[model samples]
Target chain A: MYVRAHTWWTILRIALEERLVYRGDFALGTLMRFLPIITQIFLWWAIFESIGSGSVETAEIANFTFPDMVAYYLLTMVGRAFSSMPGLASGVARQIRDGEIKKFLIQPVDMVGFLMLNRIAHKLAYYSVAILPFALVFYLCRGYFTAGWPDPLTLAAFVSSLILGFLLGFFLETSIGLIGFWFLEVSSLLFVYMLFSFFLSGHMFPLDLLPEPWNLLVDLLPLKYMAYFPAAVFLGKVSQDELMLQLGIQVAWIVFFIFLSRYLWKRGVSRYSGFGG
Target chain B: MSEQQPVLVRVFLTFARNSLVREMTFRTNFFIQCVSAISWTLMNLGFYLIIFHHLNRKPLADGSGWQQNEFFVFLATTWIVFSIVQAFFMPNVQEFSELIRTGNLDFVFLKPIDTQFLISFAKVDWSALANFVMGILLLTVGVWRLTTQSNNPLSLNLANVLLYWFYVACGVTILYSLMISLAATSIWLGRNQSLYDFWFYITNFSRYPMEIYARSWGWSLWGLFTFVIPILIVINVPARILARPLRPEGPWLGLPLSGFAILATLVCLVISRRVFSLALQSYRSASS
Candidate 1:
């Protein structure tokens, strides 16, 4: 317990220091995240107008009305905030292959902790640069504030769901980065992850937008929980019952990926004959 | 000059062959990238389906001629065109900027023939090519859907289609020029990938259904991209050519638009040449 506590703080410290130095490309990445949101917002706006001035009852088709839809997208700006992308994962995996892990293995700091923290640093840098302007534009363009429940319990739900969303993403990305141990190539793995995340997380559209059976299937998938769940929290769209259920799902996924990542790392180390071996 | 031409051709052949062999060695990667590209394209198309499906029961721009199917066709075609530009020129522009950042131009400068051509064409990753092929396939699917709804099938009018193909080629050229200019900024900044990404980010504009984002400020923003950047024109103009004809507003001011696109290409080529020379001036040995 003591060593684990030490490891967590040590990771946070390193992450904080790294976050202080901003890379120009980090700014690029932040701005890049906005492009899809821009397109999505416009796409939705056009559809809403064509829907002939709120003809459909908001409560009937799905949980979201026009204003609710806007908020859902805005919340999605940071929905998977704690997740690491395959780009960074591939870089770490390369280090593992080049046997750079040997130097780190000798260090007292936790290995996976270092990788996750580094990503958190970059994610912080990315969001700080990109999210605010986007949020302002989204709200102003939609001509409304997003609906929210002001209850303390709702806040707690949002906080836990958001943090869990990040953890789930981090563990999944790290576990996949673990593939570098077994395979010479990690790029393919990363590419596959992007595709899965896009479809499963409901990034392209709301989870309910997908037709019925697929919609139910996606909800069962962990991707929907990471991005769609938190966005639903912001919009006050999910039922309290659904919220508890999805949060449970998110926790399960994080546990699954954590174990998967640990197994892969142990197997990888057996091959890591150390630097200059 | 005659003696040097063969050497240039030989170098090009050798570079192309080796890169192909290197890429072929990773067949699994090629499949993954192909699937990934197709999935992202489909995901966006799926979003389009949702919007139009909802709108199908609704009204139009002025609440007239607002068929959901026609708009999807427009989106699919432009996306295919955009994917093509993305696959080909995006790589060249990305590589050029990186070359400046690492001061890696010394090797290219030491080589024979035009350094610009050499630097630009040396690398071709299929991530871009795969996106183009998949995007075109998706666009073709859109066309098939549109055919079921239209009077004149595109298959019957092959000639005009071929003429429009020339403009598509020109559109590709315009895209390449605009990127080369943005990439030229790297010579001064050491790493101007942010600038290239900023331009690529602007491509998000092209994904919207037409006349939807044409609100005054937004439309003109699109117009500025048409002139200064030219990426928007690559998608929108070529798409406009294929889908429709010269408007009574006289090609919707596209004649001057084409002229401006050509002039921008000239300016881009000159600026990149001047910057490339300056970057070479800063080049130092790796030991330093």
Candidate 2:
């Protein structure tokens, strides 16, 4: 137990140091992240205003009018802050591929602690600098910040769901990156993974807007937890019961991917040629 | 004249041929990448379709009198121009900044040709050839669906279309210039990757329909285009070629487009040569 606690402390220290080294990058990335959310919000607002006459009211797809879309996509921004884990996946892969992780293996550090700390550090910096301001501006503009907060139990469930959501996301991406060991190139594989994420993860637009079976089919995947369901929770759309159900599902998927990643990493390292020479 | 042009042609063709041969060893990988590129276009097309269906008979984002299909076609054409740049011009210059950092640039300088041309044309991604072909096919479909807005396909007539190709060629040159200039970072302080990231994300500015706006904002982007980032010219010039007024009160827009394309190309070539020489001077060779 003492050894594990020491490992965790070491990882946290390194992660904190990493953030300091790339302070400018984090700041710039945070600013850029706002652009997409703002662009999507304004563009969607214009689209709905023009098409809906004032707002879409067909009772189709959750009665999402022009204004509701603004609110919905804002939720998208906040959830994205919580669930997006691109750095952890790519960072770990590069470390392994470059054999930089050898330094850690020779030390007394825990692998999970290091990975989680790296993720936590980036998110802490990014969320504080960028996403929080974005969430505030969006809330003040739309009046959803206070009005949209569900009851305490519901809000608590929402936050709990997001933790599981992030875990599943990290697992999914890291497992794919782990393939870099056996495969000569994981760049193309990562691109393919991004393609799926863009569509299925509700990154661009929600899956519900698509055809019938697709909306239903997407729920079977953990992607809905990544962007869509979390957004729904933030909007006060889901009930406590549904939130609990989805949270359970997210946890199950996370465990499955974690196990899969461990298996792949072990099998892969056995084949690693230490191509450094 | 024939001797000069033939040598250039032989160089480009040989580069293309050898890259194709090298890529064939991993043909399955190449095929998936091509399909991946195609799928990207399809996803964008899908989003536009969803919007188009929602916006039937509606005015545009700015309360302008533009039809959805008109803006859609404009966006589609811009995307096609984007694909051409990504496929034809980007690979060489895109690799440049990273190459400089790793000292892999020595191999490029050792090549027996104009270092500018060779470095700007190296690393021909064979998969991108299919991407180019696929883009034109998507553009054709986009134009055909554009039948909703125009009973006459006269806008796509061959003579006018050839002029548009000239504009696209101009756009490619400017893209190379901008990329190579950014790549010249190896000369100053070796700051390529971060610079490339800035360039990569800036391409988002062009992904939208230009007809919806006058591209006056983008014209100022020209300052950034010629000097800071070349992708601005690559995206905007092509749109300028195809940007039709919603009402068509103007006599001709295509002429100005041809002129701009030529101007941008000349600027690209000149700037590129200067940048290359500076990079060469800065080179502390591997032996050093």
Candidate 3:
């Protein structure tokens, strides 16, 4: 068991080193990603300006004041930084299709475990480089967080939700990737997944702005746990009791995806054939 | 020069035909792409619908003259212009960095055709045009509603229609110019993986009405995007011409925006051509 743990540590350390080599690209890319927030600021300001009849300071839409909305968007950016698994799904599918999974079949390394460790390393590397840009952006937009920092308990809840959100994002995407065993081409499926994920995850707009039936439907889905829930927690939008319940639900979803991905992997490996020598 | 024009047209047609054949080879994938594209359009429309509902179906409070139907027209224009760019130029520009890194660009230089023309028209992504069809449907509905429901119904005339299309072409040209210019940077940067992200960020500004960026704090951004980068006018000018044609607003910033749009297109094309040429001149083939 100690030897197995060391091997995993080595895997993570190597992955982190590899990611650090592209630190420059990650830094610039993170900074570029924030450019759209400028547009959002102007857009929401205009919307609230119209709604408030020139008194933009106190106008509320869908229970979000202008500052609150901006703050919500900013916090969602943080949540997304933790949760987004870009290229992971497609990369997995590619490996499975290209017969690269053979290494894992013959080797002692478990593919899902290895991938999870690699992703954790990637997040660590990404955040190390991205923290500066994120801090600069948050500091610049500090005024928007009108309620200021949350209490310690709420802050702890926010942190826990973000970590759980990361796990849920990973397992859910890994399960989608594992579908490669059944379908040779999963790019189109991934495209469909991305389309729904972007909207339902509240990346485009707050799910609260969604009307009845739609909002209720989205609330039931696990997608919100990836983006909207953590941001909501940080903003203190959830009551104390609700936060606990929501956190529990998030854990359940993560567990569900963990099982689903492992099941897919086991079945897929049994059917896997190393066609080309 | 005139003889070369016909040859270039033939080459472009061949490229499009080849792309269609390639797409047909994966009919299921093509169909799924179309479905996904249309789904995205519907979701985007739904987002705006919710916003309009929240606003009580009124014009933007910023005095942008963009009511629900008019904003729909703007959104449709964005889709149309973006679809054309995505279908034709986006794939080619994205591959440009790979060509540079792998030194396959040397073969491109060896071709008898204009290097710029060859590089720009080598591939077409037919799946992206799915948004074009969706855009036209939305545009027709938006126009029909505008004509029927408005206190002053739109006067759709031949001249206005022609002008709208002309400006749409200009919008496509401007975007293509920006894309090719950015792609040219791959020659210097070796592998500009961030090209798409940068392009998306820059164009995100053009997706909304120009009036949204008219606040005191927004003036600098407004000026930069309007005059410096010129992305703001790409969708706004065409959408405004079609959606609010009868309005007597002379021009924005006291300049004739429509005329300026044509001028900007010419400027952009010339500048992109220059940039592409300079990058090619500086390019050291992979062998070197």
Q: What is candidate 1's local distance difference test score? A: 0.64
Better of 1 and 3 by TM-score: 3
lDDT string, candidate 2, B1-288, tens digits: 556777877889988888889888898888887888788877877777666655776755544434554555456556566666666567876677667667777887777777777777666776766656755665566556654445543255565567667767776666566667767766577655566565665665545433322334434543554445545456545543443424442432445545655776887779887877877788764432
All candidates' lDDT scores? 0.64, 0.65, 0.90
**Model 1 vs truth, CA RMSD:** 4.6
Candidate ranking under lDDT, highest first, comes to 3, 2, 1
After superposing candidate 2 on the true structure, give the runs of residues whose Cα lies further than 4 Å from its correct spot: A37-42, A52-77, A87-114, A121-158, A174-191, A239-245, A255-277, B1-3, B57-76, B102-112, B147-156, B211-287
lDDT of 2 at B74: 56
Which pairs clash in the backbone of model 1?
none
- How far residue A239's Cα lies from its native spot in candidate 2, in Å, is 5.1
In candidate 3 the C-alpha lDDT for residue B219 amounts to 90
lDDT of 3 by residue, B57-119 (tens): 556645666888988899999999999999999989988888999998999989888998888
What residue pairs clash in candidate 2, if any at all?
A: none
DockQ, each predicted model: 0.42, 0.33, 0.71
Residues B106-149, candidate 1: write the lDDT tens digits. 67778756877787667566565676666566556655665564
